[model samples]
Target: MGPLTPDNYELVLGLICFFLIFGVLGKVLLPRIERLLAEREDVIVGGAARAEAAQAEAQRVYEEYRAELAAARQEAAQIRQTATEQGAAFLAEVRAEGQQQRDELVAAVKVQLAADRVIAEAELREDVVQLAVELASRIVGEPLGDLPRTRAVADEFFERADQAAGEVQGSGAHA
Candidate 1:
């Protein structure tokens, strides 16, 4: 060539610059990029492992809560059964005691009725004897003035009284 052109010189310089820049970038920058990518991958893997461990711990706690709930239900059932038994026992005892009191009250009433009947009989006998004496004195018109006759009437009245008392006592015993 007689003289180098400006365009040809510029083209040659641009090619040399491009080769130098690519060579330096490949040697120095590419390894650093690779190391950064590896670090990012390690961080992602470690985070996934931690998340899995947390999920397992949560499941274990849930199982423990379920077991405790079952135990509580069983305990409540036992307590209810015991209370029911005790209530039944207490009711039976109260009923027995009430029956005993009623029986005692009935027996006392029967005894009091018997005692009142005996007292009434005694008083009736006394009144009958007095009326008989008064009627006999009026009929005789001597007021049972003679001692022997009076004594005989009195003895007859006493015998009749004894017979009536025996009959009443026999009837009461039968009843």
Candidate 2:
């Protein structure tokens, strides 16, 4: 036999050793390794499931938040619209009250002005009558002063003058 070839007894012993080692690895270490691999697979799959559940929960919460936000925005818009309408109504009411007050003030002022004009006309007529009496006394060269008669004459003269002025103003207006 060649030097590379084993003897029959050595070959039988090597075969026995190989069989023993293979059986030990198959019965003991192989099962342990398979159990470890199963555990690792469970960990990876469970972790992925948990991550997916967490992502689903987060999406639900985000959707809920968006819905609430949209509701809040709509509520705020309604509030603004209500406030604007109320403000417009209040402005209109205030403006109407102000206009009423202005109209009343104008009417009162016109009434006061008319009363003042009548008072002024009466005072001017009295003053004119006194001046006429004084002028007539000076021109007649005596106190031809019958006070009642002189007042009556001045009143008649003013009535005629007022009539002529009214006629002239009426004709001018017509022209």
Candidate 3:
């Protein structure tokens, strides 16, 4: 017989021992291993589902945050626009009031100037009449002093001078 070959009795004993071991492993260990594999697969699937749900929730929150931020920006822009309009209105109101005050001051100054001019004209007329009377007395060599007649002559002279001045001013304006 060859060195590697077994005898008939040894072959039969080896076959019997191999079958006993295989049967014991199948009956005692296989079901427990299958149950552990199923439980591991379930945990993996459940973890994936939880991760997906969390990601969806995060996305929703991010979208909501973006919407809120946009709303806040729009509101701020509106506030700025309103403030600008109000400021413009207030500036216009202040400018209008200033213009009104300036116009009032101009009118008051014109009235005061007119009153001063009347008083100056009256004083000049009186002085001119006195001077004319003294000059007439010196030239005639007689004290013929008549105040009323002198004033009448002066008024006539002033009327002619005013009419001449008006004509000159009118011609200047046309030019």
- Which candidate's lDDT is highest? 2
Query: Residues 87-111, candidate 2, lDDT per residue (tens digit)?
Result: 9999999999999999999999999
For model 3, the stretches where C-alpha displacement exceeds 4 angstroms are 1-55, 134-147
For candidate 3, lDDT tens digit of each residue in 1-175? 6869998888899988888888887887788888888889878997888899999999999999999999999999999999999999999999999999999999999999999999998898788877878889899987646656766787899899999999999999999
Residue 86's lDDT in candidate 1: 95
lDDT of 2: 0.92
Q: For model 3, what is the error of residue 44's alpha carbon versus the real structure, in angstroms, after optimal superposition? A: 8.0
Q: For model 1, give the 10-residue run with minimal summed lDDT.
A: 142-151
lDDT of all predictions: 0.82, 0.92, 0.89
Distance from true position, residue 66, model 3, in Å?
1.6
Global lDDT of model 1: 0.82
Once model 1 is optimally superposed onto the true structure by TM-score, how far is the C-alpha of residue 68 displaced, in angstroms?
1.7
How does model 2 score by TM-score?
Answer: 0.69
| RMSD in Å for model 2 | 4.0
Q: Tell me the tens digit of each residue's lDDT in model 1 across 19-131.
A: 88888778778778888888888778877888888889899999999999999899999999999999999999999999999999999999999999889876876676567
Deviation in angstroms for 84 in model 3?
1.7
Query: What are the models' TM-scores?
Result: 0.54, 0.69, 0.61
Q: What is the lDDT of candidate 3?
A: 0.89
